[model samples]
Target: MDGSITGHRPRAAAPVGADGLAARRGEAVERAALPAARRPGTAGSESDTPAANALDGMPRQRTARAAAATPTALSAGTVANATAPVPSALSADPAAASGAPAPSAAPARARRPGSPAARAAQAVGRLLPTPFGTPFTFGYALVLTVTSYVAGHADPAVVRALHQASSTDVAHLVRYPVAVLFASALWIVGGILSPYAAGFLLVLTALERRIGGVRAAGVFLLGHVVATLATEVPVGLAVWAGHLPGSSLHRFDYGISFGVAASVGALAGLLSPWLRWPLLALFGSVLAEGLILLDDPMTNWGHLLALALGVATWPLVRRAARARAAAPTAAAA
Candidate 1:
């Protein structure tokens, strides 16, 4: 049995020739090249060579390095996106996108000093405060009072010169229309004091306040001119017909009484019935007494004519009142 076993072992050894030896060498080289984990039937082996261990550890080291670098790459990309500029179309306000407020627009330029607008504003400012409040009427009264006071107190030559220069005589009216109009209101009665000053202040100031400055001026001028012409024309005709002397044409026909009477008559219509009727009666009675006494027939007739003209202004006043009443409704619409 020992001999037989020995004989089988030798026969198996004899079959391992040079070709088989070369094949075995090739198998050894392949095994050396491959990782131990990849070697057949040795996947879970613990007794591994140092080269096999290094080969296996290479893949683990690379994976660990790649995992460690992932966060830094992602962080760099995130920072790049966050720092990028926003497009104008994407943001309604470019300043807001940049975390800032929008800049304010520039202010408008100021008006020049010598401009028409500035001049007009200055003129209105100067005129608005005249005569304490009623600029046009009271201011005119102040000027008239001052001029009359000056003329009455001045030398005889100065007074005479002023009278000649400011005369409202029928012969002078054609040459000095403006001068007559201004001078007519500057007369001082009895050569010492102007009685018309107080009347003008009271009547004109009130009238100007009720109806504005423009209309009050219109009424006063209209009354003064119309009354002067009416009274003087008749006197001229009477003189031409040999009823009076030619000296009537040269008479000093000037005063604010006619205008005052007209204003009083006009304002009567605006007053309550109680006040209006009383004023009219008083004025009419005074005028009638003057006429009946034959104390200056021309003057009384001129006053009556002026009063008629003033009463005619009621239509204008009513129109203004209606306009004022409708203003609020128009504004709301």
Candidate 2:
């Protein structure tokens, strides 16, 4: 300590509170006495600290610095310009997007029921399909057939002409057209026969649509021709084999009526299971009538043979029905 580089006198190391200890201790006591001022760090600060000046002049110094940095002396015109309301084009319109009147609504027209255009549209629509099915063609056929029958009887010459025309010109047309025409004639004179004829018509239409028009017509015609043969062949064989009586086949009007009726019976038989009770009742009633009436020579064997033929043709019918069912299932998938 005596041989130091410079002749500096040794000063005694001061105790912890050497700088104004008495005053600092008094300030600490005062801060502790007042609850608000007695923060832990605030009680023991040095007199010449930068932190003390920051704490003392912080709010005033900040206010002055902010005022110096900003444009405090703006012109009255500039203030007005900055605060002024915007133009209408710049502002958003509440109604335009959703609430305003729609352009489409303004020109839209309401359709009236009795209008000619509406009636025409309805008439066209009826030609498509109904809840039941297409009945228009059947209705038309019925009218033609009835008019030909009753009126043809009135004038034999007209009946002859009709037969000639039908055989020469119209016979080549599809059998369904002929059948519908036949049904129409039957409907006019039908009376109690309406139910039978109607059931026949519906069955035929349903079958025809399910199978194709051509195949359906073929099935119908097959049943018809076979039923005719069933009746005719018997009588022919009876006469040929010398079993008995006068010619029965020639005696009965083995014309289109019995053949067509047989076809109807066959179609109904084919459609029976699908119709449930209604079809069963229809079929049972027709079968009973054919058996009981026995009035028409063709009637007895006609319906029975047709029903048997229908049962025989079930393979084709079932195939068609399956295809129809599968079509919709495929479409949905």
Candidate 3:
């Protein structure tokens, strides 16, 4: 009975070798893990080791899956602690970490004085609209008036010689010659000639620049000739019929100023939409002077004739302008 009992006890304990060892090891592990498990930091944790070390040796997939199973509150700290090894290299170059080059310092800009832009600005300043708002055409018309005074005093033969000249010669010498010969003559006389010439040159120069010198001269002559014929033919016929007493002998005695003035007057009307006031002022002055002061020596016919010629020539001028605009485009193509 003692042998049987001893043998049964050993056999029962024999079954507990490797399996028993494993069971004991597991029990010892649980006992060893008991302190960490019971610890305040790890209390109630299924894992005996801290989360960091448990994940260290684990397969990445299982670790990620386990991490995903954790609440979001724990996930943030877990992810931060996991990536703690990566911050040192990133801090070396913030730009490199962002995958871009560091910006270089910008170079300083250079300044230029007396440049073309400066010159253009200066020119614009000079050409700025004036407070008095005198149109350039008024000044040029005054030049024609001065020219009239010169041609008025010229010997009748000299007037005829000038009038009889070829159109080519007349056109070539018209404005400048009259300005120089007649306008300067008035200046030398120390009258209102300086203002007249200044006004004339300013207006004519601006007009010529705008329309081109050749075209401006042509328009000036065209208006002038039209006015002259209108003014002179009537006066001449009246004189020949003996209804009026003077200047059948010479149309130039009043000078060609009327024609020039008419040309300028026409240009003024064309350029300025606000022509009514100016034209009225001009005609009113003549009427007032004729009535009150100078007894109306000047005729309004020339101005009217000029306006008519200008209005008539508008179609031609518009065609020319269109042609000029088309020229560059045609050439480019």
Candidate 4:
């Protein structure tokens, strides 16, 4: 060998064990397979490993699909819940849940007979009896028509005698108290035609319904007797005082006008405000006219007096009605 080192010569050095050689080879293969970014001591290389990348990519792909499908599924569930009816069993009533009877299952308390409901029922029942549900009213009209017809056909002497007997004069009151009953209802002028039949039917029937037949009759009689006495007494006193001729005692006076006026007055109390006011106004105007005109002094005065008596009877009428309403309830108890 020349000392000038003309050719580079290989030098055989230390020999390695089999185990060490195999370990070195395995390390080299692992390093070659790894990416540069994943090599040790590289920034963020811990997260860039193939196993970590695969784990992260698998979850992200699955989550994206889940998110996209979630809104559609949520919307469908919401619509289903909104449109679906709740089951009756699920909507339990508090009472039923507590083992108590439901309100609909419980028996209703019995109503007292005199209660407003009972009165209404009774009134309905009464209404079913007649067209206007007032038999007395019809009877009165029938009687008037028959009597009028009889008077029309009777002899002149007999008709005159009937008029005399039926006169409501103060001179006849003491001796013929019975005359008071018949006198006030008789029509002396045109017979039944002198009185308004329609007015009588309507007024009397309405009064009877509102205050019952008994009270209605009381009101009529009270008006008739009081008005007649009131008018006749003044005339009697005037005649005795010589202010008028004695002929005033025999003044022919007979009609149902006074009773009609009183009935209207009593009805005013029972009527609602709307009807009451108009009725009072109308009656008041008529009375005022009579007073101003002074055409038939006695009759006008009787009408006015009768109206006053009717107004006075309001307390009694109201009390009776209340008692009637309460009677059924009291009886039930």
Q: Who wins the TM-score comparison?
A: 4
lDDT for every model? 0.70, 0.51, 0.48, 0.72
- The model with the greater TM-score, 1 or 4, is 4
Q: Is candidate 2 or candidate 3 better by TM-score?
A: 2
**Residue 84 error, candidate 1, Å:** 44
lDDT of 1 by residue, 211-275 (tens): 66777788887788888778877887898899999887787767677887788787787778999
Candidate 2 lDDT over residue span 1-333, tens digit each: 677688687666555555666776555444343322333333344433466555532222223244334454344666788855444544365444444543454765777569898889976664333434434335534654565465435576865444433331122223444543343233222332445444445555666556645555666667655665565556657766778465342342222444345445445545556664475466657676867877654456666776667666767776876787799899999
Q: On residues 1-333, what C-alpha lDDT tens digit does candidate 3 reach at each position?
A: 655555344233234477766776555434333334442224465543567345432222223344345354253566678734443464777775665666677876777579898899977644432323333444444655564565568797884565433111222233334442232222211223543344345544544544545565676666555554464556656766888766343322233344344345445544656864575467546534544553223245554555456556655655665676688799999
Candidate 4 lDDT by residue in tens digits, 255-285 = 6777888888887888789998898898878
- Give TM-scores for every candidate, taking all chains together and pairing residue i with residue i: 0.56, 0.44, 0.40, 0.57
Between 1 and 3, whose lDDT is larger?
A: 1
Off by over 4 Å in 2: 1-196, 243-249, 252-274, 328-333
- State the RMSD for candidate 2: 17.0
Q: Is candidate 3 or candidate 4 better by TM-score?
A: 4
Backbone clash pairs for candidate 4 read: 113-329, 114-328, 114-329
Superior candidate under lDDT, 2 versus 3: 2
What ranges in model 4 sit over 4 Å off?
1-135, 186-189, 194-196, 326-333
Using lDDT, give the best candidate's number. 4
